[model samples]
Target: MDDQNNFGAQSTLSMPAESIPVESIPIESIPVESMPFESMFIKSIPIDLTSTPATNWDNQSQLILSFESMPIESIPVDLTCAPTTISDEGVKLQFDPKVIEKKYIEERDKRLRDDGIDQYVRLDQERQSDLYAGSPSPRDPIKKEVDFLIMGGGWGGLLIAVRLIQMGITNIKIVEKAGDFGGVWYWNRYPGAACDTESYIYMPLLEEMGYIPVEKYAKSPELRKHARAIGTKFGLYDKALFQTELLALDWDEESKRWAGTTNRNDNIRAKFVATASGPLHNAKVPRIPGLETFKGHSFHTNRWDYAYTGGDTLGNLDKISDKRIGIIGTGATSVQAIPHLAAGAKHLYVFQRTPSSVDVRNNQPTDPKWVDSLTPGWQKRRMENFNTIVTGGHADEDLVGDNWTDIIRKLSVLGGKNQSTASADNAAARQLADFQKMDEIRARIDNTVLDPATAEKLKPWYNQFCKRPCFHDTYLPAFNNPNVTLVDTDGQGVEKITEEGIVAGGKTYELDCIIYATGFEFVVNHTNKSSLTIRGREGLELSEKWKSGASTLHGLHSRGFPNLFIVSLMQSGLTPNLTHMLDEQAIHIAYIASYCVENGIEAVEATAEAENKWVQTVVELARLQQEFTKQCTPGYYNNEGKVSDVVLRNSWYGLGSPAFIELLRKWRKEGKLDGLAYETAH
Candidate 1:
């Protein structure tokens, strides 16, 4: 039987009629002259008959050949089994290239809205107060002065504060909008919420804390507990002003200090200020018509209403057993919470704007023996190893072997050997690998969902990395439940919400509760998204200066914003494991603060020339990423698929995370602080 005819069956390669009598002879032991051909290349592998093998072939008998080198264009491709081709990764593509490309384009175009990101409405202050009313009691305002004041209570702020305390700069204050230390973790308590990245590398400062996560993917509660533990270890609780939001920041040239104001009417003066407000801080809802008319209980996933749901994060929702629940936006958040909803609700409606690429999340409990065997700095080594592999670099062995590393390994095998070069053949090779991976993802959906039509709707038709990839063992199986109804918008979202229910595809879904898993504002400017006004030298507004684009030295310090440090992803290194990037930023900030304190420097800012040079570098490096983003479906990664100039300007450093971190380390080692200008104390 021909390989093409066996589409969904195990493929068998047909052998030649006459076989060589060399079964017992080692491949390397055969004389080059005895071979049939001198230079025969099969699947990019050259036969080396004359040389010794790299490894011992004591048990070797039969040689296995790979067909990886065959050009995809050379093979006939069709939807029928007669013309199907199998990739080296064992992924079979039955659809024609033009047909699949058109299908992808059509799917993406239907989801494109004229409003773009404007379709989402940010919650007003009144709604914010109602959601964040978890504090014990309100307190009177006061005035205070501190050596350092950090905004945000997430990993970024926690790591920076810990490093500063270690350096003996102990006079610190942490202002958190939430009632607790955990930033995103504090807000996201929806059912099935957990760190998608492997916890061994995702959780920061594990070695220092001497802690081990109970599971490979740590859940929200455990993550929140760990955040508070870090705060307690470093005495951040006493210095933190909970449930207070920063309003404005002004630099005082004469005093060489920062004057800060907050919602609680407190005045603060600090020698230096750092804003670690994370990217996904503010929650947003879609601006669907008649949203206010919905008479039922509604809440965003960020502020999960446990009282209404009658369940905790573990998802034993006793209250909603007879209730009809409707969830909007099938992104990462909804992918997690849907399984629980399907289990608890009498009827569940899933309104999807676009389907996320879901993969297997084989979570396992941490082994005690493995924990006991870790040496000092083992976590750091593991983090670096994972980072190297994901960034398309070679490693002796994969430390945290998971789905993430597996995908990158496939890409590295094809086109990641040298990512700096933008050769046409390399780009094509990488794209082929991406196609193979996405094909496997779609096949998993087909095999899991029993219904043919529903399975087809759940399959994502874009690149693997277009949107954030989701991994859950139960997301797909939840659709098999009879109570669950998938309202696929065919890319277009729900038309509107009515007093009775939600209107989508000319049908009404009467839901007792509506969960807005619409997610947070990700691809917006820092000042606008955070709602913090910053005035620098000569009364220069930070927002106005960055209106055109982001200009900074190493994405940290602006030219005029003296002593103001920003910990954000814009124009900086980006990694799938964000905590790794945060830790690197924290270390750099701590080093700078230490240097200034050791000397008599009161204010430091990036020089104009250096800032301009770095901006140019960022733009130059972002070419490849910009091209890739243009081809992706509408999502936060590409600013709803607009890919505007401003978006390109605010792109992350095109070079991978490892290179970006190395640049920072090199600058610190030089010890001159080459890009910054300092003002000494009088």
Candidate 2:
């Protein structure tokens, strides 16, 4: 089948004006709708135009002009160019390269800024000490022969601990630094502490736990409660080591055990070690000038300071009635918090380096009837439904999520309203149509906001995928309040901070409090006191190995780091529904653990061969989705301003969630388990 020819353009044969009868080819037969000028590339100056009789060309001199292959270097992506190959018969085509590359870059950078964030300066020891002046020590050492040592108390850790008990693997111990078990949820009680994806889909084990979410988008309180409930249900609360931190873990090669150490130098031995330390647990504060001496109440959103604002986690900031608040971010975390601040504060200033593409969330409660209808396989069904629609698969209906990705599904319906498939050129046209949908949403912001200038300033200029898309009914309207103000830095970001407040665009915005919504650094600073050193086999440190870039197999295990597994989205299908990704990771980890136990294997590690193949697969798949996701502004999504590198090929799998899950299932079923090694205890 000629896949290229079927999609590019309809064939148009030209005849000399003198030779053809006037009515031989109707003007309408020229295929005005089918022909997209964007797809053609001129390989050479002259082509055998005489092979097919031309219908409209003037008997031009020689009929021998050479058209260089459409400058592959300068095709505009906006123009649809169908990939084609030509023989003596006729020409084939694809989109204009110049437009696509430009659009792709702009959108890629936006995604980077949204997710691959950076530049947080660690507070000096003295400053950190002052900030925690009245707080107790962050960690407590544990000295016991715990049945099961769970490294993190986040949702993953909480869930696994519960599951272990359900499996009769009790006598468990959960180690956590925070005073509670919410993991990232406990720490990030920011102003807008709500889930962006539908709460039911985003939250995990809810139905299994017999819990109904209060809102379509669950708030921090409910999410936190869910975490605690997991711990409580599994009896994890009975022997958990709260306010405790893991210092180091070493395998006792002789005993076939793990020697766990804590900050206070206490030692304990465990038969099994579960590293549930989630990726988002570490609070990443970017380094900015004068962060040390801001001379005002300031805190990372991850560590919400209610004392400064006199409000609870519900976001009633009565104390801020007299205080001016300045927030420095516009990512997912900030998106939820800003509206509350805008409503409560005497004056609110938002310091935006880049704008997030805001969409309508329309979050509502889960219908009891609907919940009851979801039976045994509901979670899997929901996950599959979401994945198929987002990845351009045929589905009966799209449930739970309505982000910009919905446009992709809408375009796939061949005969539906706004049917993009009416033309064979639909695939290339789909992306632009999605952009227009986003533009219409953005324009709605202009219409919604009271101030035209503020609306224009807040509207994101980049493509939708450049950053993770946000859905909020309140965010846009919050800006319309007289007390709320948006201070856009036009991508240069805040200039500098003064003793009183921040200076940007030569204007000073004085504030009683400065909030750093600034995010975390990818590579933790080795020298920083907070960062723990990860030493692998042969005394090889993870920092040194990944200095050039990060690498992993399925974003889980890495080469040389045998028996070490990372809890992150590296090369795994990551989507807006974070729980979906986490669930997939949890399943992968569970399978690994089960494999070890079932096989009586002492230790399992990824083989060099497996790692190489997995990395190659990740790269190949990522390149396919690069045009869509890379357009995001500088954020962790594209590795924070560093683009087009192979080092971090296994960063985040572009395959989306469902496909990755299927891949994992197929690999496990295949039994070869391609790139892993299992060894028996000596």
Q: Which prediction has the highest lDDT against the true structure?
A: 1
**TM-score against truth, every candidate:** 0.87, 0.78
lDDT of each: 0.74, 0.58
Per-candidate clashes, comma-separated: 0, 73
Q: What 10-residue stretch in candidate 1 is worst by lDDT?
A: 1-10
Q: How does residue 301 of candidate 2 score in lDDT?
A: 72
The best candidate in terms of TM-score: 1
Residue 26's lDDT within candidate 2 is 31
Residue 150 in candidate 2, Cα distance off native in Å: 2.8
Colliding pairs, model 1 = none
lDDT of 2 by residue, 1-682 (tens): 0000001111111112233221112321221111111111111011223332333222321111122323323322323335433223222334343354465456444434433334544433333232222454545455777545777777777766655665556666777766778776766676667666566666778767877788777777888888888777766788677666677766555555556776666677765666666555445555556655678888777667777786766778878998999999887777778887887899999998778777777867768788777778676677656655554445666775565246454333311222212222333233333444455666778889989888877877654444556777888898989999999887767878889999888898998999877654443322122344555556566667766545667667766555555665555555555566667666666666666666677766677776666666556544433433334456555556554554246445433444456667766676665677767865
RMSD of each: 12.0, 12.4
Estimate, for each residue in 356-415, the C-alpha lDDT of model 1 and write its tens digit.
989888999999999988899998899878777666555789999998788777654543
